[model samples]
Target: MKRILSAALTLPLLAAVGACGAYGSSAQPSGPQPRAAAATASAGALPTAPGSVTIGSADFPESELLAHLYADAMKARGVRTEIHADIGERAVSMAALKEGSIGAIPEYTGDLLAYLSSASTARTPQDIYARLRQAAGAQGLTVTAYAPAQDADTVTVTRATADTYHLSSIGDLKTVAHRLAFGAPAPTRTLPYGLPGLKSAYGVTFRQFVPLAPTGTITQNALRNNTVDAADIFSTDPFIPRYKLVSLKDPKHIFAAQNIVPLFRRDVLTQPMADACDAVSAKLTTTALAELDSQVANGASPDAVATTWLTATGLAH
Candidate 1:
């Protein structure tokens, strides 16, 4: 997976990514900020029954934007959709998926795999996607093709902090770990890719662990405000470079390669829906994804941004 680039998400993720696309980031569920698409032809969350089909996303702009991409693509195929946006934390959405509340969501290969199997040894994209498919299948889910784009979690520090500490790799923190505070999602305490793993793999033990929102923005903000010395910001989040944050290197490969993919309910994946997402996925490279994120951050609506991307890439007309 690292051969190309890196990974982010929104909650229990069963941490999604309490994974990201911050997947390269865990839970607390938020209520649905449902953004229902106008009724059209049918696809995406291809419901076998009568009710409206819903696509779910974690509480971050990237995830929401991903949901919009799926919706917009499906719309082009004739299916309208309701986005169960901001479906808080990991557990709630995982439960929702199991119970049929949402049919699909954008996910990171590594993060989703990590969330399902913390003990897994899979690493490469092939291995990770294979593992993830198994894990998701057991839960009655189907994963669409993964996009080249990724948004892995990065142990980011402000340029000032990086300069002050002479840090570049995550292992560098070991020397000053005891003096600095770490900010991330609440579940970081237990997630293999978070504090405990960092400590075990890199011997990193921060002076404090601030439980920030799973939303990369909050944690990234805390890093900027000096509320926390280092935070887990998504690799593709435009704010990283904008803020001049330094993403510490992971020499030990603590974080897995987290490529973006579609995680969906098996029953909801019609051929048209799957084909539409796969078409878009084929075009979603890391650089393309970062630009899409930048657009939303600059105030473009997720739907608008997604539509623009689809049209530009000729995935949609």
Candidate 2:
């Protein structure tokens, strides 16, 4: 989705997303700790076993769906595969990639960039991916070219909550954020574009921070059921429109461009396998991804969704 931030956003806050700590109330809480920090002992020190072909995913529907697509495409090319679904967020996912627990996983370019360096100023998709590629290369990871499909993070609210707070943009939450409870995946609370970004960029802090699961269903249910007054949701999530939730504008580009991509361990990525993944990346557009995600969210198995899309695109038969 193309975001057009309204004129209401203050000009000075434009720089808040990049280098903060100077802009806000300084109430940034230490968010959820990543689960992978414990396993870094073997990271980069040992090579993944040569005979294995495993794909992993973050603990969310889209990530799992993408994993299924990649595995199926590789399988069609005579490479057998196994999937490790719901493997937590970037921290855990990255650890899996580093230690060879997983040969590959689905990832977003900008988010991966931010994880490497939260202060990075890469904005456009090309710049972000280039920076991400360089950073990832240094760590023995390979980043494939990104897809047209993007799902930038958004600070969303129910229509009722939006109306109550007159919330139209991220900046609009500045005044009443303290009274609201914010919900999102554990990693988001600490990500620069998540709670910290909100606090620095908009001087927004909530009454409480609820570290919920990364799954869209669980996150959306919390919002719809009033478990939390606000949430950080992905832009392409089907529930954004289906549930009539309002995704607030981000004029500062805090969340940045998040095109879909595959992250592979350098040792595990072969020419044929990389090409198989790239074929899917080239064919998977935002609209196509949304449909696939919707099917999975509504009870269709990710294997089934992957089969249909791969068959239609001629990536698998």
Candidate 3:
């Protein structure tokens, strides 16, 4: 999926048939607390148990970064950590969490809520987090502190049309949508993040809707070349700036906040490891994440990009 992001024409289709995790509510655990402040390392790193903590990530770059940070932080706490990245789709990832095949992974609050309850009401980030905490606790997962970075749903328009019509928000596109072409993943037309919600929320009926690849090299090029006037992009996509395009703000906030957050098994996150994970969350911001995504989209490896950002942010030394 990461490789598919680079080419517009070859973007893979998202499996939108069902929401994530079909497990029973009885599987959920009980009791969780807010993350604690980062404590100073007393002396040598904490002691590792006999077993290892498994960290998993979905196929996205940001998820991979969060997984790397979690693994590295656990290592700093004297825990043996293993990262299982690119672990298929979200449903599979959630099932792994339930079965305890992996200890931790990155997740979004809004997406979590929708997956858990299948609700359509767009809650604020705070509400979403609290709701997910209770829901995930029952599932035996703990959602640690949420990071400042948000890679939520976004829509973008070519610079040509944006500048020509003074368009800035999704609302602005309604006036000129008939003259525009929409390009995005085919799933976008059906998913809440795509055309269905787009039309319902913004009343944007475009001149055409074309299936393109993910929001990386391919969809970006289509937008840049005016082959598609608009595309479904992520808020953290690097090409938003590179292509000189404008992201139409969802003022109505139809899309929920998809902030980066660590989801770990309760047993894996000892006090020291929890604190380290919290520190990484505290320092990450949307702007910084976008820059990192740019580096990867520009051809740098995700591992290299994650390592560089971790070192620079003092999350790793």
TM-score of 3: 0.78
- Computed on alpha carbons, the lDDT of every model, listed in order, comes to 0.68, 0.68, 0.63
RMSD of 1: 9.2
Segments in model 3 whose C-alpha atoms lie over 4 Å from true places: 1-52, 77-79
lDDT of 1 by residue, 1-317 (tens): 21111223322111111222222222101232111111112224445333235899876677888888877787677665789888865566778888998988878777678777878897555567767777877777768777766677568888898889898778888999899998876777787778888899999999999988665567666877889998776667676656666777665566776777878777776656766777777777655777788888777888899988888877777
Candidate of highest TM-score: 3
Question: Residue by residue across 139-174, what tens digits does model 2's lDDT show?
Answer: 887776677776666677899998998987778989
lDDT agreement of model 1 with the native: 0.68
At residue 141, what lDDT does model 3 achieve?
A: 64
What is the Cα-based lDDT of residue 116 in candidate 2? 79
lDDT of 3: 0.63
TM-score of each: 0.67, 0.63, 0.78
Candidate 1: count of backbone clashes, pairs at least 3 residues apart or interchain: 38
Better candidate by TM-score, 1 or 3: 3
Clashing pairs in 3: 8-218, 28-138, 28-139, 29-138, 29-140
